[model samples]
Target: MYTKKNYTIKRMLSWTRRYIFMFILLSTIPVVLYEVLDWKWLHLPWLPIGLVGTALAFIIGFKNNASYGRLWEARKIYGGIVNASRLLATMVNDFITNEYALKDRTDAEFFEIKKSMIMRHVAWMTALRHTLRVKKPWETTTNNKSDQEVMKKLHIQEYAFTLEEELKDYLSKEEKQAVLSKTNKQTAVLNLQSKAIKELKLDGLIDDFRHVEFKNMIGELFTLQGKAERIKNFPYPRQFATLNLFFAWIFVALLPFGLMSEFEKIGETLNGSNHTGILFQFISENFVWLTIPFSVVISWIFFTMERIGDVSENPFEGIANDVPITTISRGIEIDIREMIGDDKNEIPKPHPEYEHTQM
Candidate 1:
């Protein structure tokens, strides 16, 4: 979804702002209380705290790695979608021929069949892409070739707009973005469009040559769909995540106790001077602040990274770097309409800004 190779840096900074604030707040609270109380911690050893910190660090590392795996899986699925969509487009150009165009089916029927089937396929691609990305549907226009002949023949000017309006309500941003990563939406659109091919085969519009070609394309589309479904429904095992986080938490919570001994020894050497005591008070006052809050920050950073990774790998879910399913679907609609001779420029043009921004 993020076309830029290093785009995750920006994404991390933006999404983690709230976590940073919360972690800091949690840390600062303890520091302030200890400084005010001027309390002395008589006898705890710091060894335990060091052990906890090291253990938690390892657990956090595992969590980050696992989360990344899920995200990468989503990326691979979208790669398939991109290939499948291009293949379908190519097949559309391959299968339809002059043989069917010059058949016993009347001039009107011939044009109607060709036009209807092609445009629908285009719509199918758009719909599938959008569905994966969960984007709104749009009017079926073939680029900017708006002409009266194309519109009246296809009946798209009126009908397409309605579909667009309906789609506007149905597509949610998160779903659209997440789906884009796996290229799942495009696969779905292809499934629906498969019916058209089946109907054509039944009606004797498409001959054996065209039928075979279309069948192969359909298989690829379905394959893409299955792969996406697997990734979405079965993200990496949760058991590992739970254990790692639990252990990491326990380790982080106890880290400061080890460090505390050193801090207290320094205080004793200072001979409890009111001024030195004031400083010790300041430092020790926030033991929880230094250890617990710091651990929380470290924990939050790891968790937040995992969360962002979860959303990004899917890309069709409309997270910051998610693929824009709505836009792609609309583009497919535009292309298919034109390929089938439905050139109503009335269909919306792809936005350059949005082009790069889609999941």
Candidate 2:
């Protein structure tokens, strides 16, 4: 999500502001203490810190892999839902065609209804997509007006109000409550669509084979919807992730002290201002500021990987680089509408500004 080269440092600093402070504070304590005591030997501990880096690497590697698995699994479930929706809708259209052959309506009337159902299926795809993304279904005024007309054509007047105020007022409290209920509102819409097919069967609008096929398609859609919800709800475990992360920072923080003994011995044994002093300096260079940088730089890599893994583990959250669920759902809706032979020129296009640079 943040591939912009110029903003990379800014984004990283923002993500790890607290950790950056801790790393500095933790590293600075030793340096300040050494200066206070005037003990040059204290600097040798940092060499031991270098050992923790190796163990920290393995911990971060394991956690990053676990996080990627969650991200990848969420994406796969979404892809499955898209394919299932398409396949189910296609089956409905095919079945409806067979049912139409045995219907009493005129050929032209049958043709119109067939086209209508196909187009309506496309609208369902769009609705499902928006629901998953938690976006308002009515993005444009034109879309609302179009959907109103669509409902009217389909004779689903209960769902075609010009405004919320247009809803019925002549009702008891319970009746008003029924109108306000979320489950009833959605079920009403689904029932209308499903009822149309049921009526078609009764009126010989479609044959038994076609009706059965359409019912099967809807069943599959129901199954796929459940599957998507399951994947989103049941996330990966947090305990293993938390344990691994704690150990990584702990290892890096404590590693320098153990390597201090060797350097202190070298400093004590070697003569001052002798050939051995130059020899000691040569080895000491690898154990001083040089080693600190080595340790911090190594920790930075693990920290960066850990941060990336954290973002990916929750696919539904608005983190950068998660599944583009909103985009995918919108595209599916538009495609389904086109397939159903609805408004050819009014197909919705994906927003260019969906991906924000200022997250």
lDDT of each: 0.51, 0.53
Number of the predicted model whose TM-score against the real structure is largest:
2
The residue-level lDDT of candidate 2 at 157 comes to 18
lDDT string for model 1 (260-353, tens) is: 3454456455545555566566665433434455446565755564444334444443433444445545565566556545547645576344
Per-residue lDDT, model 2, residue 189, is 31
Q: Per-candidate TM vs. native?
A: 0.61, 0.65
Pick the lDDT winner: 2
Q: Per-residue alpha-carbon lDDT of model 2 for 271-316, expressed as tens digits?
A: 3435546667666443433334444555566776776665555555
- Stretches of model 2 off by over 4 angstroms after superposition: 1-10, 35-59, 98-180, 183-193, 255-287, 353-359
Model 1 poorest 10 in a row by lDDT: 138-147
